[model samples]
Target chain A: MMTVIYIVYSAVCFAVAAALLVVALHRACKARIAARSERLLAQRYVRMITALLISDEGAPMSRFAFCGRRGAKSVLARALASVSRSTCGDGCGVVRRIMAANGVEGWLLGRARRSRGYGRARYLSMLASLPVSVSTANFVGRYAGSRNRHIRFWAMMVRVVADPAAALYVLSTYPHRFTAYETAAITAVLRRGLLPLACYPLLTSPSHNLKALGLNIVRMFGMADAERFLMDIISDDADRDDVREAIFAVAAMHLPVTRGEIVARVRGMSLSERRSLCRRLACEGYSASVIMRLAANRDRHYMETLVASYKRSLVCCG
Target chain B: MRQVLIVGDSGVPRDMVAAAAECAGCAVVCVDDMAQAAADCKRGRFDRVVVIGSAPFFDGRMSVGQLRPCGLQRPELYVIGWHQSEHTVLGLLEFGVNQYIAFPVNLRRLCRKIGAPIFRGI
Candidate 1:
């Protein structure tokens, strides 16, 4: 009985090892094949895209039409997206034409619709880079109200790209506050073009996040025309984050904030706010006297530390 | 054939730039290492060297500042997130950059900057 048990155990162990080895070999082979195919696709895409860009005729478009074939759509989409991202002006127009010729939009929309969860979100996010079209917007708009926040976020991005003029409106109505990642993504989109003329509404929105976004847009775009709106926010009782953003925007744009205005704002602000304003003003090359005025009745040690740090930074930069 | 060298890590679309340069009738070489790029530039083989500013070169080991001294001819600084700031422009100019091309790069302009004939259909 003991001998039989030992033989059975050895047989079981050998069988398990053999199965594991087969699985490992299969996986390695699959990976190698995938890598090889990917390399070939990359080489083909380089040749095709370069020829397309160099050729004066539309012959390359028909060549790119093979993107509709099985397994090639994703690779083609990725290659074209890379090309589109690295180019602007007439080059971008050329890429757009290629995408159109290849039916990339329809493939992406179909994939996004069929996919679930993260897969769906991935496809939607990819759509953000493509040129805006009515059909794409209509499809993406259905998901703007999705329960999944990721999908909703990407859907909103597509909508924003589809109609940039209504960006503020789309963002202000979002059910949740914009996360840092979301803010950065939206900022990237806005960076591609001038901020819409209707951005003023974001400042006056009830949501603190929207107000913060507005302040950031103002700072980034150097919208000096919004100085009056920023002044009102500084003086009014607003969210601390909004106030901080407003001050930073004011300092960044170098919009003339009078000493009287600063003093008045300081009077209504908390000690921390006063400290932040002083530090920002000092960094922006404001006079020491003005910084001292802002620092009045606050911790002298903190003020000294801030001034010392600022001087150290200036020296380091120089 | 004009030669162009692109120095950037994975964050940059080096392959795309290479393809564009190739289409514009130039031989393109891409390297992720600053040392290798400096070495290539030292040979004076490349007509233009494009340094991507988006890569993480902050360790003080190698930087554009170091690469500028490699006797590079027509070094173009290509930076993403390019804001219209005079200070930033002047800073790049001080780095011995002959051109500051912001993303998304105008391929036609890039070809002209690199002394290559712009493609007819590009």
Candidate 2:
């Protein structure tokens, strides 16, 4: 019993010693972290001071950037990155400043897209911080359809950062696989301002994603011509749900001709088909009374799905 | 005398699948949607099934709502479509799908890709 107690005491002492050692090590780690952080901050402060002292040598961008200019930090950073690359410094460093002032967005974009080397990647990263201009936007466009996936993704990001209009041109031209990503970017561009009609064709493309995206653009822009095309496609297909989507598009348009056409078409359907068509027409804000009468007897194959969709629409919406 | 069933929606890729099947001199039964395709899959006396469509060739709006028919008695199935479904294909593959081909389907590449494995176990 005495021996066991002695062993237990020793084990407890060792555990306590280990705990104390861990606490000491933790304190040492914290001190190291603080010192490292202080050194990094001092280095940044020194760089800032040096940059300011050199600002008077005709360095508007680097000066403005050093002085913490708003709305152009990204641009200046881009310029600095570009001039730093491409043939070293020359002409009293004024040439270097001019290059910095000259849209780093373009330079980095150029390197990222066209150049292949370690230096180009550094330039690309520097340009990444700036708001891209038109030329930079155009440069980023080169990678929108890149065979390299990473290059394509970065190019797309640069499009959003650069001139958003140029980004639309890229999204409109990018492969079908990237449609969802393209739509999100293009929608942001549209939110900023209207996209051109040339972009309309891509919306209703055969690709499902593009078509869905097109439907959104059509909804947003209220383009009647696009709606007409939707109507034509819907009318040609015998598919009931597609036809419903078409009806919804027409109803969204709220055109007098479409309303009259819907009534006429609804009047022509057999009572069985009309049961389903009536609900769609009603959901489009026509009278639901006609649909309720026909719903007394609807097709068994469709009754569950259609009625559930119809009831859900009423439940959630109304 | 084993056969394959193909579900083709409107467009170029579908046509390409048809042409390749013809070139191989294998009989293929084609349909427009999953409902008809699934029905045919069960009834057609086939050894394999292939569905070729764009990203959502089998959207609920486009076909019967089922991913794989509960009563399917057909052969092994292969899908060459725009993509694997969000998560549905794993279950479908578990059910019986032999393969799932995601697109940007290059016909030449697909033919080359499948040239070996398709004929395996034959």
Candidate 3:
């Protein structure tokens, strides 16, 4: 009787193991099929984009049956999210950035938000994956203000390139902490376009973090075109010193300013004031234009720093 | 209106497109593959052909490579590779398709895709 009991127990164990193995195989098969579907979808996405990019003759292909694809759609959403993040930083791209910033981006981001189904998890993952900022500015700008976090992140990232003020505005109001991952998102925006940080059209931001962050961003801009915008916005108070410093910084970078104009403006200032102005420009990575003026005898204090700044500029630009 | 021959793979979004075409007053015939699609083309049953599928189907009604050489009686061909194999779909274009739509199709949008091209051809 004992042997009989032992045999029954052994039989049950074998059956349980077989059942578990079958379940495992089933899951593996489902996963593989899902993966292949994802690959196929991504291929379609690139093709469509390429076609859109190249063709003016044909109507855009718009018949996308993006419904009921719990598995495949989720995977596709994740893929799109990854592309956005790779292009921007977070999975968000232009449309989402704009939506968050401004509508087209909003709708898509909304879709990403509202998605549910077997595959919705994948969409969520992609939505969270923003691209690096430095690289993806222009791409996002094309569809700028995309509110979908992933797409908007890309667009905002691109804007950060040329105009960090806008990017910083997005970040400070970002509703979430900027993670290490988000640095790329920020850089992507900057790489696309550098907004004159000192002279953006921002109206009323509530957070000091936003203000301080905005100021820092205004300072980081390449200062190549800051001259025009700065001249326009050099008044009013928040940080007039920072703005003047920035102006001097731009001049010192040697961007293209009449020294007669700068000297004429500063003729009444003390020697220390003139030296500080030169140092500000030297530190801000201006071109040699400002240095030519400083190379004159009376303003000779910054001569050494200007030479080092010029060397550093060459190293940085090259 | 121009006619379109639609081939329905087992799992694609053919039904939606076909219904859309039919609703748009397009003379569309539904078939399963080259044999039937070709026959219909020969019989003056269709002016163009559209192939669509839903799930990943094995039945080979219209592989992109096979599209050009088949010498269908139809003047234009469109393939909707609902499953998203870009290489396969792009290959179809090389084979001389008017266009390829990704599926699960937005029927309303698809009607416009085929309709505009057909109208322009006229």
Reference contacts preserved by each model? 0.37, 0.00, 0.00
Q: In candidate 3 chain B, where is summed lDDT lowest over 10 consecutive residues?
A: B53-62
CA lDDT, candidate 1, residue A179: 72
Sort order, lDDT high to low: 1, 2, 3
For model 1, residues A1-318, the per-residue Cα lDDT tens digits are 999999999999999999999999999999999878865685577556644654436444554634556678887776766655455554445555777777788888999999998888888887876665766987789998888888999998888777777766777788887776787667665555523634688788788767877777787667888988888787774576677677778878776555566567666777777777777877777656656766757465677777778787776655
DockQ of 3: 0.02
Off by over 4 Å in 1: A1-8, A32-36, A39-60, A63-71, A91-93, A163-180, A194-214, A221-229, A236-241, A253-318, B54-59, B63-65, B68-85, B116-122
A84-197 in candidate 2: lDDT tens per residue? 221111222443344455443344555565675444444444543334455675666665565655456556655554554554455545564554455554444343232343
Give me the candidate number with maximum DockQ. 1
Model 3 residue A128 CA deviation (Å) reads 10
Clashes by residue pair, model 1: none
Cα distance off (Å), candidate 2, residue A2: 12
Better of 1 and 2 by DockQ: 1
Candidate 2 docks at the CAPRI level of incorrect
For the predicted complex of model 1, DockQ is 0.38
Q: Residue A251 error for model 3, in Å?
A: 19
Model 3 per-residue lDDT tens digits across residues B11-98: 2144445555665567777777676665666567455677664222233343433433354434566666522334455555565666
Find the candidate with the highest TM-score and give its number: 1
